[model samples]
Target: MKKSLVLLFIIITHQAYSQSVAKYSNEFMNIGVDAAAFGMGNAVVANINDVNSGYWNPAGLIGLEDKQMALMHSSYFANIALYDYAAFAMPIDDRSAWGISLIRFGVDDILNTTQLIDSQGNIDFNRISLFSTADYGITFSYARKLPVQGLNYGINAKVIRRIIGDFASSWGFGFDLGIQFKHKDWKFGLMARDITTTFNTWSIDEDLFSAVSDQIPTQDLPETTEITIPKLQFGVARSFTFSYDYTLTAEVDLNMRFAETNDIISTSFASITPAVGLQFAYTDLVFLRAGVGNFQNENNFGSESLTFQPNIGIGFKYKGIQVDYALTDIGDQSAAVYSNVFSLKIDWSLFR
Candidate 1:
């Protein structure tokens, strides 16, 4: 009865918060890996031996025993091209662990346009072209178990880069901090991402020209512009087991904008999401999971629509090799069809 009440409270509170504001980033990273979505985003506390822990919650790495590695890839709708992530984690000693991860997101075949000017110094024609943009991040992470109790904490420092064809490129840095605790059958976790508001400054090249009496003369043009990416995110999750193989988990997350930036469009409005998921495992080798969150709410669109919902996943393991897959809809216009994503993950550990 207590568990049921707690779950109800989480749902009601999240719904109330979701109505206030709605916006999120790293949408590609949020679809989540296979095993995680199944656990209702409870990975911070649930992950035990998964290599993707580098992305989910680095603090979880503290429990790792052997060197672990994983690769994951997914495809988004409209050929938007999503992220490919790879991570590696190893124990530095009995009390410490270190990890590294790489992620890449790219858009293929984007149309580029250029304005054509006539001798009269007036626009004549528009030229259509094609180009691509890519974003990548490399992360270094470390974690340690606290001596006071069953607590674990970690941090990740990342170097981020963005590229837009041959015209522009920018660089920046960011960080993530996380904590996890587990005792008996109860688990708790929290993580704050993008703690530092980082931005990529681009260097632009411009050729200036002045028109006088139908004659054009070239002039000096300043090159470069600075654009900032605001940072904010906080997530918490808890889980309880009903038996050895059956478990339920709940997660709540809040995303806020930096006070320094107030532009509505430029600023990501604060939003909250809460989710519930169920897991069924058979002898720990095979598992099935499902979850639902932010379904039919106005902040995400309207109460009549569902954004994140009905996620399902499966996993299989043999020896030290693990494979997982998940399917989910991330609230796109064509979510029922094109917005769906298929994810694949592979994990290998040298020791059990």
Candidate 2:
């Protein structure tokens, strides 16, 4: 049965590969949802556990004990943008688990300068309009342990919505699949994201663009479609025990975007995106994480040095409750610098 399922997935992916991916349809979905995961440079594919696994790698959810719930919130890019996430997970019988989660990213009160000056030729600050852009998604996730002991597989179904004030909006749907294999202190993982080629059919009218075209050229525009290319993530992790009181886990993940073979780079596979993360824990009470990733090294120091992605996080777990905090880079330190992420988790054992 697993073989058949795998074959079906391959066929569907092959069919969707012909379509081109667009920009910003469900882009918020790419932001790391968990503080611990983000602190590790978004390298949780093989090192995931807890409720946030619903977004990182649902396959990791099967390992969760009892029922769990988590909540997270953060502000990005100097507080101009905000992100929030929540999830719940519980085991089903002995071999499977189910999870549900939601994510929201928004930028509020953006100034619209279309009507900066009034007809009377006097500058009017009131004429400046404020609007918002928001992207939201709800996900249903399931994970099951394979008959082969240490192997697990999972899937996620997502419903997404994007809004830009009252001017434009879009609705989209997508799916993700993941697998994990663990051997002693080592683990491996793979994730197929947007497997069916997530696409958003935008609803836009000329009225929204006609005004801006007056300054440039009044060219006709057609309907627009936003497509999200399928992405594959490969990860591996190893745990090292320094002593009975302390343990450290190191992990790395590689991201390959299948649709980019034909894009602006022209070369097949283009460049690889590598993420590395480390976690230090004392028994099961406290955890510290540091990571760096998402670096597109163009080999030019001047331009490449400008790209920065780093994170640090700490967590505390006691009596089935966990609290985590992370600080991640947002932009250049000169302008808007960093973002803070906080999350809380409650395990069923505490309630029992």
Candidate 3:
């Protein structure tokens, strides 16, 4: 049964590989990073100020006080897939900051059963082998405070890499732009992902592909070029201080995609999904966070119903090192079950 399922997956994946202007291409990049952000429903664009900013809204990097680094890991699909992220950032002078980040999502140790049945129609378990599929994203980011005291802007140059065992591979590139403004306790942010459409060119190993070709004689070679469109994220946040020892921050964000989908708000020209997050801190050392996002309309038979994902997290900071953990997809609104995400952030100043 498992071998049959694997064969089906390979066939479907190959069929979908002939892509042009594909929607949800390079989707692994959208899964997000940092347990703190995950706990906050990924709504930190306006007030982010750490190494992780390289993945959210680079403009937020301007708030970094010193050199920093971060790492995060999460598992999905009942531990069948793994997601990992790492980042580094440092301030340049008083008004600029630069960062680099990497993300990897992969499913490993899959039984390649394309040859499970021998040419003579005999079943041979030894013909099975193992392979893996993975996607990676690396980003270089820079942020600078504008002359307008409260404004800042950032840019990202991204490189995307993907591989499917020894069968295929691809490389892609893209850019992102972000801006942020702060006034009193209010913060606003905008992030244009793939500001210019991203492109990925694929290369298939014909030698290994011959096996698949033999199975599907009618299948043609997959297309080489794949395109990803742009998406926009807007955020607003406010901080409230309750006494000298306690504080709370609330943020709301909207993700706009150019194509219509099952998001809460959809139209022919665009679709909008909203998310909200909240964080409470005590003297900036301990934190509690929560957020809800991924609002979608589900169809049951001929009826429609609303569903959303809820995430919660906690954090601890000592000196300049912070650790965070989050429980996401609490209600399993999506296909994947709940996942535990953990992240670590280090401030170089702590060691200095």
The C-alpha lDDT values of all candidates are 0.55, 0.76, 0.89
| Candidate 1 segments whose C-alpha is farther than 4 A from its true place | 1-35, 38-49, 111-130, 207-270, 294-308, 330-352
lDDT of 3 at 296: 91
Candidate number achieving the greatest lDDT relative to the actual structure: 3
Model 3, C-alpha of 148: deviation from truth (Å): 0.7
Which candidate number would show the highest TM-score if scored against the true structure?
3
TM-score of 2: 0.82
The digit string of per-residue lDDT tens for model 1 on 99-143 reads 888888777675433324455657543543456667787888899
Candidate 3 residue-wise lDDT, 20-132, digit = tens? 45766788898999999999999988988789889999998999999999999999878888999999999998999999999999888877887777889898999888888
RMSD of 2: 9.8
The per-candidate count of clashes, in order, stands at 2, 1, 0
**Over the stretch 256-351, how does candidate 2's per-residue lDDT look in tens digits?**
775333122324644357788999999989999998776643435455332447788999999998898988864432122478999888898998
lDDT of 2: 0.76
Q: What are the TM-scores, per candidate, against the unseen true structure?
A: 0.69, 0.82, 0.94
